[model samples]
Target: MNRFPLGVWLFALALAAVTALPYVAGALNAPSATLYSGAALVPSGAAVDYNSHLAKMWQGRRGEWDYQLLFTHEAHPGLPLVQGFYTLLGALSPFDLALTYHLARFVLTIGMVLALWVFASHFFETPSARWICLLLSTISAGWSWLLLFVPGATAQVGPIEFWLIDAYNLIGALFMPHFAAAVILQIAAFLTFEAWVRSAGAAWRGLLLLTALLAAMGIVQPYIILLSLPLLLILLGYYVISAKLLTWRRALWLLLPLAAHTALIVYQYVAINNDAVWRSFSEQNITASPDLLYYILGYLPFIIPILIGARTFVVDEADDRWWLPLLWVLLVAMLLYAPFPTQRRYLLGVQTPLAVLAAYGWTRAFLPRISAGRRPLLTGVYVTLTALAPALLIFANINAFAHPQMPATTAVYYSADELIGYEWLRGQANPDDLVLTTFGWDGQGSGGRMVAALGQRVFMGHWIETTRFEEKIAQIASFYNPVVPDEWRLMFLQNNGARYVWYDDSARVLGGWNPADAPFLEQVFSSGSVTIYRVRLNG
Candidate 1:
């Protein structure tokens, strides 16, 4: 019996345990009031992305292919393969939505870590260096010392966004499915490429695997493929120049799969751009772009090590494998500054290659000078220094969960009864039926965005989703405004194809009119602070 298999299993179990530790603490020590108020134990506002996926999963179970991602304008393509797997598991044994979500996240996180370890092995022969790379990849943090010394830095730039940094693997894995999948696929692709480079017998097998992974990446997260293209091209150039057999003809042959992958990506974007609704929606929802200095500050841990590693590579031609990771970092950095809505998101899986480079720097540059006995102590010091910022961030998130600082209106607004209301709405309404509600963030009532997602129904939920958001919001306000005549309100609802109007405490604050008072609206359901009224189109 091989103990190696047992050892690997135990190691995986340990990783899972460590990964779940903070979440376990969060659940156990969640603010009593918040727990009672139906808030998720992890955090609020983090659910926006996860909720969208949950919506798709819910739809997927019903054999529906299209997802009404409320944050976007129209029904976007769902990750059927990913969602379908979960749906099948859900069918076999039921679990709480949040529990299932976290479980999936846990699996993906473990996969990412394992993939990073495998990828690092190609560049590093020493077990110590490989393990160091793995740990640094998982826990490395940004430069927070600069903020402490610089005047007004914290106030001007806000706290370091740990979620944006490459080393914050837990955040990406736990909260985002696409991100986790992309990370796994990206590393898997890299591993296959490396194997292809080294193998003589099964090189075609490696190419095939790499192509499948790249295509899967397109489906899992198109943006990842976009970021990966330049890096792949750089790798092709490296092989053409360095390898004897990798002549232009063979390199072009290698490029075929990538070219096809790129075409698919272009086609997907063209389809998105051609759709009037999706185009407007994506344009409106474009995230605020960050500056180069902001990116430098965020990835300083990896950047510093990579710079050192670059010098080592240049000076020593024997370690030519270093060129791959160096190119990866440079290409990704270029894409980060590329003019795009969500360029920052490309940083998700970069820690893998950076970890490799950083490990190289540590072993080649830093460790050679130290005595064997003293290396462990110095390594501890290096790791602690690297991990400082992430530790602070993890502590901040935990503290926020235990002693929440967000306003009650924003944090604990969604009660269990309200979620029940949304579930009930899902059961009652047709999937295509549009529900009209307030479109702004009032922070006082149940959000229509939640209703759109959890209810699995179409809605004029928020400005991000609704076309002509200001006008729609104003119209909704007028429809609920007590001063507005009942006839005008009725007309507005009919014009917008609104079959139902959901009113909550926030709605009352924004619009003085009550649904029960309108002759053209019939109260269908009422529970706690929520009320649902069916529009009396006939009347």
Candidate 2:
């Protein structure tokens, strides 16, 4: 009759209740069948991404061309993995695809939280570890952000993005073929846990397992996986120099794993550089300044435990062997590579490990000091504060998520306006007729590029990328930016597949330019938020 097991089970059950609270609220409180603006859901731009993929999937599933998802559909290899997972779950039903993806996101979030908690509990003293686990499981920025908001305009500012991040990370963990490939990462995480919990002999096995896990994770998402190395090295270096249990023989075994990991990473880097498929992957400017506030918000709850507990932890002299501050600075520098607007999601991989460190710090510093006499008071205070933390996160996310709203001209897939526009277009166009889209009025209201609006099998529209995509955008921008003559607009239309033109009065122009020539373009449809024109072919 061990009450300890009962206590642990109750604690875990309580954690589950806390985790599902938002879902329960969202289900009951939000409008029927309406998702909250920022709930952790599927991938952001999900409707758009799903629509695009479905078209491609449909072609393939229908036995048209064997599922050719090249440049037109999902451009990256990672997306294919997501699509494949969803496709299997959906089993060819569009409704199922949407429903399943959403459900999968929730499941993924739960799994991530569980994994983090298990990692904490396995590595630390019970009560201290339980606090760390509770804090992380209940109130991380990712946790709040995922539950409180609904999916909307930008992929970066949506709830489903949390699941997407988890999906990407987990996929990298489960798949990948290399030694420290994605699949191996879970093993590595387990091994790392073992190192802290077990004896020296057990720790060596953990290192060997860790090396292999890192190889697998590397295969799944090499960029993030590779970035993880310096931290691992720092930890390994600490164990080597400081641990009382470390003998030359044991150290040799540990170093062997490290050497193998390093060699494999180097090989992967070279192989990726040589491959045409991944050649452009690293070439893109995926850099941005790290948002310290975002990191704080994202990781603060779990991290606070580490901060409070920092002074009591036994710090190995080896901890300072490698300048950890310098390594951290380097990793921070790596954030600068994130592109233009500076996305926070790209930094999730780095943040995950850091949160764990913060948790460890908390346990070592604060948990042991609070005597049993004061425990209830401390627990009550922590719970009260923790309760407010989720609310604050939801508020912050809602405030941050709404700022970069889409313009009226941009068709956001699954948006009300976009759905209306699609209904209008379907009514106006014949089965065989073409409807050419102008810039911004593309694919199913999902803010797709203009080329996406060409609903017909044979049509082209303005798309922004490089060469043609860039050149075409430049051409349209020239007319749209500067006040242009009617004929110039007409000529521009001819250059693209200008079967029809659509404009939204509410859309903000990139430059201060007016379209006085709107009347001359043969106005075919006009509404408050949208305007359509059919260019006279001969004229």
Candidate 3:
């Protein structure tokens, strides 16, 4: 009994270490990337659309333009919501608004920790089990890093704050918009599972919450929410089978979340073609095929121990019959089947279960095997290591990943660089002048909110996602695929918005890959990676 309380304290220390250590390192390593030093910093890149839309939401409530920019600008919805809410909380100031955003993010991280505790406490009657659950929650690969470095996690940096990997959406939700969405989803799951397990009767509340959450997630980051649904179902199934005292009333609670989720799906179908977007999934994220083995290893580095523990940890003959086996089967299936040829981000579906498995593994290895005589020494060793792992694994990787000195990749630099240029353009461009760049993700018009931020019009860019973009996405694929046309070059510039073309070094690399004989555009100005071109639109 004494050990349980001690273990809880150890877990609390571990949680603090996991969450706080990385941010300290990031702050110490600050100025890693180039700070946008020029003129007005406008929303650019993929985030432009999300920023513009969210800003539009605040229109009329405040000045349509100023409030939109103030509330929704600066790369994420998370900040806006935080700022917006704080503004509402009092007569708002920028500092208060900023504090509210970070404070909310910190609180959400705590909520996640609390959820892990509840989840662990319920499942594991053994003190060891509780310890493992708490440990796993702090250390799980995606969950831990995601909570720490992501803007929603720290309420700073780029906007890609959603559950997905997109820079824009993540930034959009950092203000706790998506965090709120995710928490609502998990809470619904928690309540439904609670009712399901204890047979506590139907939870109409979980169902209602689930509907609102799914709807919000759909409107914000639809694909991520869609991907998460199957895994959530599997988890729900695990909950339904696990609770020892489940009643028919508890069984009815399952229907509530499901009904709510189903209604949202129906609403999405009527409002937008989900199947259409899903069908494009295979084509859009064509990276190296995800290996089942690699994903499993990523999630569970100590699979053998976990499996051994599951096999060894026997329930009493009177215990819940369906619980252990169902959890195991669901975990195994998710591990084996969750990975596909698509992006690794889709693997997020399996993370929650993997966290559970990791928790189980930690408990089995570290908790029950304690010998009374050596318990103090063993506990000291375990506590020391648990505290160190976050510093070692989480902080080290975040430092490497978020380092500004690292050369930007085609995918990574698009938004940041566009912000740089948009700041410059804000001073240079007149209201009558139009900023021209490549269609989609040419890294020029890709940041439309930046253009809008400058009060200048973008001739055309990726954010518009025009009818011509279907082929543009295909052309983007041509960098890796064989089917794309050479005409993509001129077509991209002329088709959408191009009064003056801006070409970065990346365009040159892509141009070399093109098979076409079209004449290159004339370069008027050259500055490092940023280039200006006046392309004859007709040619």
Candidate 4:
């Protein structure tokens, strides 16, 4: 129990509860007039992003083995392996989408907390240091939280302090399991490789574990390699040069898993690039890193201890364990600004290593210098300050749920009739059928994404997945406008090969044109204000 203590379990469960509570409460309290999406209320909350993931999960539920781009309408060669995580979940889930998603999320949340704790345990001798590291890594948001109060700061600064899920543990788990899974996989791979390095007789076991973890990563989010590979390489390089472990045969064994990871990633890249539709989606999916200052401020109190740990490591070269976390912190710091499109992905659980270093630094370096009585006081101050961002996150999420109609929440709802309309259309439309609806995902735009995610291919949805997002948005607006001639509308429908028109409450505000006025339209389904029209030949 000391190794995997009760405290970690308690801490993990508490965080998981915090993450799950608002969404559960929101669902229970939702009025019968509307169907709760079972997503947290939002400014970039669980629902918006998960809709895309839920789409993949929805496909899995339908027994579609291949990963199809459901957000955008196109016939492209789908992958059997890519993003198969959600697909796997969909296949395994007996519950509805929302329930399955939350259950998986809760489990993954607990797993992520435990994973971070285990990873930290390797570095810190005392449970106190490990626990402190866990707190810092999981929740320390720094001065970045202060930016939320600033009039224009969060937008200008990238909101890494509090909003970005990949930037922190609690938010990451709260957003989606894939985010936390990325971290989990990385820790598992690192530890497995580390074990392989130390164990002479059963080194083959490490290689096999590495292969499995990397393969799992391929399905979960291959972009995670943008962080994991460099750190592993650093470990390998240090071992080869400093420890003199570079007997060629042993080196080759270690190199094999690294090679496997690279080869799999390269193949995935080639496969994605081979598909025109998916390639376009990939090209549009850019997550460039924000300024370095954002990160420095975002990590706050942990940064000081991380630096102390680094200095101590540099000065002493005492513990090899210190080497890994210190190098991880430095490498990630540099990678955050690399010219790669997904540079910000390097932020994935970086705070974990930094927190490990911080705990090491404070206990080993800082504490001995201070008086014992004052040490607890200093630690108390540190914990309180570090707790700021996490406390704010909890408050913000709860507040959003309490006031569902707040500006931050947006149009995070679907009417009962709207869901029923989707159900009827899902039964009618084939897998490849194209759905045309207003371009908006939240607020004024039609819930085309909701339609798309529920298993139909929409004409356009999603910021990144949808090819030519702005152009399609304009074209969709024009298509919805009453002033547009039926000839143009007919041509637009035919040209895009859109099989169904989704006109819901939001779409109604865009234009009041009746489908009966159009010669090529046949009303196939209607529920209250929501209408589904099937395209037909004018003859």
Candidate 5:
């Protein structure tokens, strides 16, 4: 019999299709005013980051690396691997950035499915168990539907709120490059390391492959390496203890990847300056460190199964195979609350191991106890019960496509004409030119993120970009505040290095000061309510 049954592949495909339906529908009927609004098909928190990445890739295609001048100080410094990956895609479709975005999404979706399957296969021996694990991995819930009405139930216990099955990984894989690529590479690394562990000391090939995988992960997402290294070490320690012999050569092989990872981390933090790397750490600082209760509730499904099968996993030498997943869950739980700004990121790539453990629990402890004749019926009922949360999650996500939430201003929130104006600016402006526009809210014409992303130029202000954020906001207020003297505004523009000013209905609403009032400013492009003004420094 094939180790991975055909049923597992079929189920994986089905799950992928189910999850992708909403995005496909949104793409076919994209929202008005935005190109590739298909990204909004799922309500992802990282939409802005992903959109910014696409813009950077587009800018890189045009021979410019520093894409988001407003967010980071230098060009193409952070997420080089992610930027390069999409840059290649953008080059393939030189004429259309939107097409490139969708193509990247497609690649991410396929890649995630394959990675999940490969990772799960390493832990599961039975096809049925693997299928169960795959399906469960795709769904999440904060509350159990069965206990919805009970007082202080899962829903009522706000303190215990957590993703029963996190759909973010699935949603992000389709839209977010940093998330999708890092997750894919993380799984590959885990698989490679597991192969080496199983090979004992003899498989030099596995060690080399593991080293390469860790290095690649470091380039894409160094934090993943940071979170993964301790767990790998624990696994290595387990092997050393179980063998009862001092295998110095094997110990060196295991330490090689960790050493490489440590070097990458040092270089990324110490060697690279002017990178505006802090944006990644600071922007999402508020939600970076979730509490321990949140994680306990989030992985309850797997936790219950692990607890039930703890003895089987501990005492039996045959149960050594189960140690990796258990260790992974424990390590992830500890790291989620670790004293780090990106603690929440450790949650990524965790579900696969959790799913495997849950499946093991179901087959070994739960299913066998039932009578043989009733097993199929009971299994179907159990599967349906397990799927309820994810099924609802999928439905809710699909519903969000029609009534999408307003994301951060940096996302694909601009109207088509506004985008056209930004495209025009990209062609006409120099690489170093800075544009002044409104700072907050995506309300009609107010947000100036378009210039920063599409035009590859600096803007006056952004919420996430901390460099001179307060100073720039004050300058922008003074320039746009109608009560301010025109002379003061002109001096402000000159002092701040702003060469272009974009005026749309948003700029008008925020600050009624019009560029036309200033003789030094010349109108360069106008379409409908939107107009671009060039600051003639000499005039």
Candidate 6:
């Protein structure tokens, strides 16, 4: 039932290839030297978030099932699912960690592409409709390309991010594998539940399938539960109020899966909120929905069409299939503006359903009214408007990250000396030893977060993962200030559990408190301008 024609398979592969272009270019252009720092280069785009995953995988490679916030020094119990699928990938895969990352991304990208096609196949009967839906769902971006002409637009994400890019499938698939995995599972759960709903009222096997899919999604990508559970509730509501088809047995089919999945969701919620470190991470995990204009422009190609066909299943066809995706689109649309920290996350896989409705609308409602000569012009315009925006976004990303002839040292890129500094500390420092390095946004000081990925702790690293990120930044700044007394600096290091201070050029840029000035700091390793000094605990 999930299989599609050969053309569809090839189309999926092609889309996956599009997602891979930036990474391939980044790798070919990556800089090399006699010695390198860390196990991986900062990924071309989204380096900070990418490094956070590296920290998780590094911990997982060490055989820890629970993941700690390696970017921060705060002691807290590790969360099970927080290690995420990447951690599992690192633990099981024998290849180099960097290679493991790209390999998994490629495979997951393929999976996401195919999964989306299967979902489209279930909705659209005609090949033409299915293909149109595929194009819009996969590559379509907001009309943000127009914004590329605005002054200073080049400085930011420019056209691609006029709305949040993460809302779209192309960006979601290319993001961390977990995001891809989430999309794949979401589509899978969506398909499975629909199948169960259409089956015999008392089909126990269908309930089991629905239960397992929900439980799995809940465990791996729990934030999605925020979207999925409410969807299931509304679907059941439709069966009861709109159709009057749900008998007690049919109710059991939906209720059982809901109950089982709700338990997992509640457990996950309690677990995350209970831990102090993770609580901080959760509080900082804010993605409030953008203004109405961003989304309107972002999804402009499909919005009117989806509205044009919102009643497609009700008027043109009689079946349970359309309600599932239609309601999914509605639920996500309404909730995107709901009061919540993770409001924008409801967008995962939403465009697929919207695309499906848009295609249906075009074929059923809009195309029939248009003249034959005008239809071709409108179709071309629609296709171009949808595809060009995201294409430009991809090109912008590649231009910024992959075109550089030589890799420059930045917050993301490690210098030879910085790499040497990290390698020395890796061998010398014990597990959980907190290393002090000031965090900076980009360029020289930015690479400090990687110190955590190499298996040491950082006093502060990730802006989000580190507890009280601003407070820690202030503390580090004051510690390095020239006015701070040596006596206070010595006590500060010991108080915060800093066993070693990685005083590099970046750190020097912060203040004039040289390692030499602090007699309590015993210089143990030095490479170029980077030096590692052990805090004298007893002196």
Alpha-carbon TM-score of each model against the true structure: 0.86, 0.54, 0.57, 0.94, 0.82, 0.90
Per-candidate alpha-carbon RMSD to the true structure:
3.8, 9.5, 10.3, 2.2, 4.5, 3.2
Clashes of each: 0, 45, 24, 1, 6, 4
| Each prediction's whole-model lDDT (CA) | 0.63, 0.42, 0.42, 0.75, 0.61, 0.73
Ranking by lDDT: 4, 6, 1, 5, 2, 3
**In lDDT terms, how accurate is model 2?**
0.42
- For candidate 1, list the clashing residue pairs, or say none: none
Best by TM-score: 4
Cα displacement (Å) at residue 427, model 4: 3.2
Worst 10 residues of 2 by lDDT: 171-180
Per-residue lDDT of 220 in model 6: 66
Over the full model, what C-alpha lDDT does candidate 5 score relative to the true structure?
Answer: 0.61
lDDT per residue (tens digit) for residues 1-539 in model 1: 24123444455556555556555655665443333222233333443444445555556546565433443224444433433333443344366555666676677776776777777677777778877887777666667546667787666554345435333564566455456667889888876776676666436777788888887787666777656787777776777686653667656656756976787677667765776766666676655435566667766776776676666766776654666677777777777767887666667777777788878888777778779999999888888887776566556555655654455323433455466667778789876566665546432224434542464454455445556566666776777778889888877777767777778766787767788888888898888878888988796
Error of 5 at 365 (Å): 1.3
Candidate 6 lDDT over 255-284, as tens digits, reads 778888888878768988998888998898
The deviation in Å at residue 430 for candidate 6 is 2.2
Segments of candidate 4 deviating more than 4 angstroms? 148-155, 405-410, 441-444, 447-449
What lDDT score goes with residue 232 in model 1?
A: 75
Which scores greater on TM-score, model 3 or model 5?
5
- Which scores higher on TM-score, 5 or 6? 6
Error of 3 at 20 (Å): 6.7
lDDT score, candidate 6: 0.73
Model 2 stretches with alpha carbons more than 4 Å out = 1-95, 141-222, 231-287, 290-308, 315-346, 349-364, 383-389, 393-417, 420-446, 449-539
